[model samples]
Target chain A: MIGELELILCDIGNTTFHFLIDDVEQKYFLNERLPDFNETIYYISVNDNATANLKHSNDDLVDLEQYVNFKTKYKGMGLDRKIACIGYDDAIIVDAGSAITVDIMKKAKHKGGFILPGLKSIKDLYPKISHKLQFDFNTKVNLDKIPLCTQDAISYAILQSIIEPIKKIRKKQQIIFTGGDGEFLSKYFENSIYKKDLIFENMKRIINANNCIA
Target chain B: MIGELELILCDIGNTTFHFLIDDVEQKYFLNERLPDFNETIYYISVNDNATANLKHSNDDLVDLEQYVNFKTKYKGMGLDRKIACIGYDDAIIVDAGSAITVDIMKKAKHKGGFILPGLKSIKDLYPKISHKLQFDFNTKVNLDKIPLCTQDAISYAILQSIIEPIKKIRKKQQIIFTGGDGEFLSKYFENSIYKKDLIFENMKRIINANNCIA
Candidate 1:
C-alpha cells in the first residue's frame, strides 16, 4: 500500500460506464453520462503501476491485473459489486436508485438482496401500454407529503419498496444507503444514514482491499 | 310511490353498466357485489312484480328514461356518478377502487369528478415497467391500513389522492367513499362515510329523477 493510487474502481449500474480513481480524500469521477441503450455493461480500470492501454474484456467484469498489465495479479471482478463492497469490512449495503439493490456480506458469505423498479421507471412504462395514463411525472406538479393521487402514488411506492427490506434486515446491523434517491429513503428511517459520495468511498475500499494506496 | 322499497339508490363510475334499478335495497345489493367478477352483475327482481320487467326500465332514474328497455338497462345511464349522488341531496362523492375518482355535485352540477388510477393500478404499472417485480394481489386480501413499504405506499398514495382532494374542495362536506377499495379508505377520515353500492344507489336516483316509478 505504498503508492499514490493503487487501483482504479469501475462501477456499472442504472447508467453504465463508471470509473473511480482512489485517492486519500476519497475523491473519484464517474462517467454516468453513458447512453442507456447498450445491452451490456463494460468497464475497466488501469493500475497506476503498470501500462498497456487498459480496456474492458468481452465479459461484463474486469480483470484488473490483465487490463493494467500489472506484474502482481488479481482475478476478474464485477464493477458494481466491487464498488458496492468497497468501503465496508463487514456490513450490509444497499444502493437504491433507478433500481433498488440490497447486497449483504457476513464472514465473506455473499447473500444477495433484491432489485425492484425505481421511481421514474413508472413514467417510462404507461405510454407503451396505454396512451391514456401518460405517466408523465414531470408535468410541473407539486406533490403533497401524503400524496393526493396517482402521481404521488408512483413516487411513494418506489420509495417504499427500496427501503422496507433494509429495515427488517438492519436489526443489530449497520446499514448504509446511497443512490440518487437517498433523500427519499432517509425520510423513512431516523436511524439510517445517507451517503451521496458512495462512489468515492467505494474507490477507497477497493484500494484498501488490494493493499494499494490512493 | 307504489313501490315497497323505501330507499332509492344509484351508483356509477368509469364504466356505465348499471342500467336503472332505483331501489335502496337493490343499490345495496349491487354495490356490495361490485367486485364479484366471477358472477354477472345483472339481477332480476323477477318475483317482485310479474310486470316489473316491462314497466320498470329502472324504476328510479327518469333522467335515463330516454334510453329505455326495462328488461335490461344496466348499460343505459352515466356510470360512476349517479349512485355516488344518491341518498345525498347535495355533497361530494369519492370512489377509490381500481381508480380514484372525485366527483362533486352542489346539487346543480350534473356530473363532476376526475379519474385517476387506484392502488392496484399503480401496482400493475410497476411490474410491467420493472424487470423484476410482478404485481400480484388476491381479492381476498384487503388492506385497511397505510403501508410502510412499496405495496402500502402504492395503496396509500392512491387512497390519499382521493381523500385529500375531497377534503380540500368541500369543507365540512360529506365525503362518501365507495367502489371496490372503499373499505380501505373509509377508515382514513373522521369526516368520511362509505357507501358500498354506489352504482346501484345511483340507478334508483336516475329512476326517480326520470319520475319512472313514483
Candidate 2:
C-alpha cells in the first residue's frame, strides 16, 4: 500500500469516467466528475475522463485525488486516450463507450488508436429513424434471433462492431477494457479482462514492477 | 443424377437467384432482370438497388403461384433470412454485408428477426459531411480492442444487438451464419456454423422436403 505503485491512469469517454489509485487498486471516484478514484501515477486509462472533453463538474475531480495525491502526465490531453497510453508498457487498452478507443502501449509509449462510435449510438441511429421500431438498446440480454423492430437492430449493430474487430486482431497480447461501456462490453468480448478501475490496476502493475515508494 | 432428384428449388431475391435441384445439388447466379427467372416463386425485396418497384416493369408479379411454390408461409419474408432458417432446428442467421440482417430460427420455424444498417453506412455518413475529423467505424484486427470508426461502430452495434438477444433466447442453441458478411461475423461470434451455401441448401431442403417433382 505504501511502497507500491508506479503510474496513475485516467480514462474518460462517453457515459462514464474510470480512475484508480494504482495498478492493483480499484478506481475510487475522481472528484465526482472525473470518474477515477484517484489521479496518482498508478492509474491507467486511454483518456482521462475526469479531465476529458465533456467531463462533468470539478468537485468530482478533487475527490479522486485524495487517495494517491498526484496528477496525470498532462492536463486536458488532446484525447483522453493519449492520457491512457502516456507511460504504459506493452499492452492494449480498449475504451468502449459512446465510442470505442483501441490503443497500444509498448516500451512505455502510446500508439495512436482507432476511434469509432459505441453500441448505443450506432444502434439508435438506424432503429429509431428508419426501422421505426421501439427496442431497448441498453437492455442487456441474450437474444437468439434479431428483434423485429428498429431499436434492437441498432443496438445489435453497435455491439457486433466491437466484437467483430477484436476477433480479427491477431495479437496475443494483454487486453484491458476501460470506459463507460467497458464493464458491459466485458460480458460479451471473450478472453478479455474488464478494467473498471483500469488506472488503479495499471498503476499497481507499474509500481510493483518498478517498486514505487508512493 | 436426374432420377435421384425429385424436384428443383429456386430462390429469387434482390441480388441473386439460388437454385437447388437436390440435397447434393445447388447453384447461385447474379440476378439479371426482373420477370426473368424461369422459377414460379419470385421473392421481391425493394431495397435501394431494386428495380421491381419501378413503374417501368409491367409483367413482374410473383403472385399466388410463386408463393405456392415458395410455400405461402415463407412469403413476404426476408429473402436471405427466409432461406437461411429453412433447415436449421435452432439458430440465428447473421447476414453481415453492406447492410446487416440478423434472423433467428427456433424449433424449425421462422421466429422472426431484427434489421439494421451495416458498417459502411455509418462510416459514409460522416467525414464527408463533417470536417471536424469525426470518428469512423471499422473492424480492425485488434482482438483486444474495439473499432474506432463509423463503419466498425455500425458493425459492433449490429453484432451486439444480435448476440445479446440470441445469447439470452437460445437457452441452449446453435448459432448459424450466412451471406456475404457471414465470414466476417462468424469469426467474432464464434462457436457457430457458417453456411456459405445457405440459399442453395435451403432450395435443396425445400425441394427435397416436398419431393418437388415436375
Candidate 3:
C-alpha cells in the first residue's frame, strides 16, 4: 500500500451528491455540479445523470463495481448496497435518503433487499399526484401513535413505512443505519448503530483489496 | 322521503373523479373536464382543485360534509375518510389509490388513521427526484419477499409498505378495502373484504341519514 495515496470518495444518490475528502464531507445537489479534482476519485451511484456528471475517463473515475466482489440476484446491484456489505460480518444495512434500501448481508453473501421512496421523497409525492396538496417534512412529530392533522399524519406515516417492515423482520444480525436520515432512525431503533462517512471507509477497503489483487 | 327522487353520486379523488348514476359507475380525470349534470349531485373530495371544478352554485352540488354526521380529530377530515366510516359497525377501512388512507372506525367512533403515498405515486416519485431515473409501476413482481432489480424492488417495497403496517395493527374488526388498488390488496389480505363501489354505498347511506334529519 502507498503511504501517501490521495483519495476522494463520492456517493451519488437520487436527491443529493456526497463527497468525502480528508474526513470532511461536502454535499451537492445531484447532477448540478461536478468538481475538478486531482486525487484518485472513487464513486458509487444509483443515478445515471449523477454518474455522467462525475464521468471523466474510464480509468480516472473508479465505480465501486471495480472493487466489490459479490454475487447477488439484483443484476444491477447498487454501489451503495455493495459498500454497505463491506466490513459487515452479518447485518441489515439500511440507507435512508432519497430512497430507502434495506439489504441483508450474511457471512458476505448477499441475501436480497427492499427499496422504497425516502421520507422526503414520499413528502414530495403527495403534491405531485394531487393538485394543491401541501406537505411539511421538517416538522417534528410523535410516531408512537397516529396523528390527526395532515402534516403530522404524513410524518408519522413516512417514518412508520420504513420502521414497520424492519420491525417485522426482526433478524438477529446487527442493524447498520447510514445516509442523511440515518441519525434520526437511530433514535427509534435503539439497537441500531448510526454510521457517518461509511462511503469513505468503503473506499479505503476497496483500495486495500485492489492493492492485494495488484 | 320522496319515493321518486333521483340520486347522483360523485367521488372526487386526487387522480380520478368517479360518478354513479342509475346504478352505473362513470369515471373521469380530475380537473380535466367538468360534466354537466341536472340530477341531485352528491360529491366527496380531498383535492380543492377537483372540488372547485365540481362546484355548481351552493345548493346544486352537495358536499359529503353536509350529509355525513361524525366527529374526527382531523380538522379538514377528507370526505373519503368520512364516507368510509359510514354504514359500518366496527371496521378498518383502507382506500388505496393516488394516496393510501387506513382509517379505524370502531363502534362508529373515528379512531384516527394513517396516510401514505399510493403505488402509482410512489413509482412517479423516483423520476421526479432524479432526472434519468424512470420506474414502471405496471410491471408485475413478487410482493411476499424482497426483489433484486430496481423495478421489482420498488414494486415489492410499495406493496409491503402498505401491507406490513396494517398487518402489524391487526384488529379483530372487519377490514374493508376500496379504491383502484383495493382489488390487489384484497388478494394479499384474504380475510379482508373487497368493496368496489364503497363511495356510492356511503352516498346512499348519507342520503338516508339526511332524509331522517329532514
Model number with the top lDDT = 3
Q: Chain A TM-score per candidate? A: 0.56, 0.53, 0.81
The residue ranges of model 2 lying beyond 4 angstroms of the native Cα positions read A1-78, A84-98, A102-114, A118-121, A124-150, A156-214, B1-79, B109-119, B122-174, B187-192, B207-214
Per-residue C-alpha lDDT of model 2 across residues B104-162, encoded as one tens digit per residue: 66676666565656555655544433233354444553434443333443444434544
Scored by CA lDDT, what does every candidate get?
A: 0.45, 0.49, 0.73
DockQ of every candidate: 0.07, 0.12, 0.62
Off by over 4 Å in 3: A1-6, A12-17, A27-36, A42-64, A138-140, A212-214, B1-6, B13-17, B29-36, B43-64, B130-135, B138-140, B212-214
Whole-model lDDT, model 3: 0.73
Ranking by DockQ: 3, 2, 1
Give TM-scores for every candidate, taking all chains together and pairing residue i with residue i: 0.45, 0.46, 0.86
How do the residues A5-32 of candidate 1 rate in per-residue lDDT, one tens digit apiece?
2444444333333444333232123332
For model 3, how does the per-residue alpha-carbon lDDT over B12-120 read when each residue is reduced to its tens digit? 7766778887677888886566657765677777677767877743347777666666788775567777887777768888888778888877777777777878877
- Give per-residue CA lDDT, model 1, range B41-119, as digits (tens): 2332212232233233443222342432322112222233444555564566777665555655555442344444465
> Tens-digit lDDT track for model 3 on A88-201?
778888887777788888787777887767777777777776554577773468765667777776777777788887775657777888877888886777578888766667
* Per-residue lDDT of A113 in model 2: 48
The fraction of reference interface contacts (C-alpha pairs within 8 A across chains A and B) present in each candidate is 0.04, 0.20, 0.74
